[model samples]
Target: MSTTEEPTQGTTISVTEQAAEEAIALLEGESMDTDIAGLRLYVQQGGCAGLSYGMRFDNEPEEDDTIFEHHGLRVFVDPASMNYIEGSVLDYEGGLQGEGFHVENPNVVSECGCGESFRT
Candidate 1:
């Protein structure tokens, strides 16, 4: 992870160290090449708030996707999704009461009661 005072230009999102570690392990388990494979983050219309965060392992990013590397984990986001999730942070919280992977999106103005959706 580059930890300079300035963030990488055009970096719209980042992943926490813990989340990156977990994601790497999962990618390895899937036998996917971490160098090219990445987790795709996007927004979809659904849930009570009209927008929901979606994530899935992608073999590679699309030509129009914006890619960022944080803590050695690659995250791919499309142009449309970038408008809604800029400056967001992806994190993982696990314990007895776990809240798996979640996005802390600064663009969100409100979230649904279920916490699965948000309105920007």
Candidate 2:
């Protein structure tokens, strides 16, 4: 993976305030019926560009997962995916155009035209 900024010193990823708040809101909504723990962020081998990002609400972390608590929200990242997403900043954006969680990954060398996939 190519990186523009220096990789994070000790962690795999960084979570932004907006992303943290959005994640917490989703978790809280689901927590009304069940106990929710955190969100998991990982990369999978797929997509037109060869890599795709994935996220899901998780009740617990795996043995090899790296966890980060940011702005009162917990985020989990698996060991293998961590290498491709290291130094990435997770953020949430809203506007007239669109609104969603976005990954500002310095490691991305190129991205698909659809913007749903990337290559290192």
Candidate 3:
């Protein structure tokens, strides 16, 4: 995996090459620009399962966030959600059922049926 040093941060955010490649491919077909800059992974409360994962393409990093690189892709994680997502893998899966990005979160204790939410 490739690594990038954040100009003013100490923590490193890691992303797998497979995840990066999949993100790039998906973004290329979207109305958004392919120059993703990086992806932002965060967690928020309020889902039916108690918590939800929020992701977005971000070109800038927050003051308290850590940045990292993998397979030529950049990943950003907020300080608040970092601990919950640490060691988790981000992947894109597709089949006759559906296609989307899924997070294999070790911290997750349970998930709701809709798959849009989870809890630790």
Best by TM-score: 1
Expressed as tens digits, the lDDT of each residue in 12-66 for candidate 3 is 4456667788877655555445444678889999779988998988765677676
How would you encode candidate 1's per-residue C-alpha lDDT over 1-120 as one tens digit per residue?
Answer: 322233457556889999999999999999999988989999999999999999999998888787888887888888788889989999999989775998999989999998999999
**Ranking of candidates on TM-score, top first:** 1, 2, 3
Give residue 111's lDDT in candidate 3 (0 to 100): 93
Per-model TM against the reference:
0.90, 0.86, 0.77
C-alpha lDDT score of every prediction, in listed order: 0.87, 0.81, 0.72
lDDT of 2 at 101: 90
The 10-residue segment with the lowest total lDDT in model 1: 1-10
Clashing pairs in 1: none
lDDT (0-100) at residue 58 of candidate 2? 87
Instruction: Quote the lDDT for 20 in model 1.
Output: 96
The clash count of every prediction, one per candidate, is 0, 0, 0
lDDT for residue 83 in candidate 2, whole number 0-100: 85
- In the range 1-120, model 2's lDDT, one tens digit per residue, is 333233457555778898888888888888721223788899998999999999988887776677777787777788789989878889999999799999999989999999999999
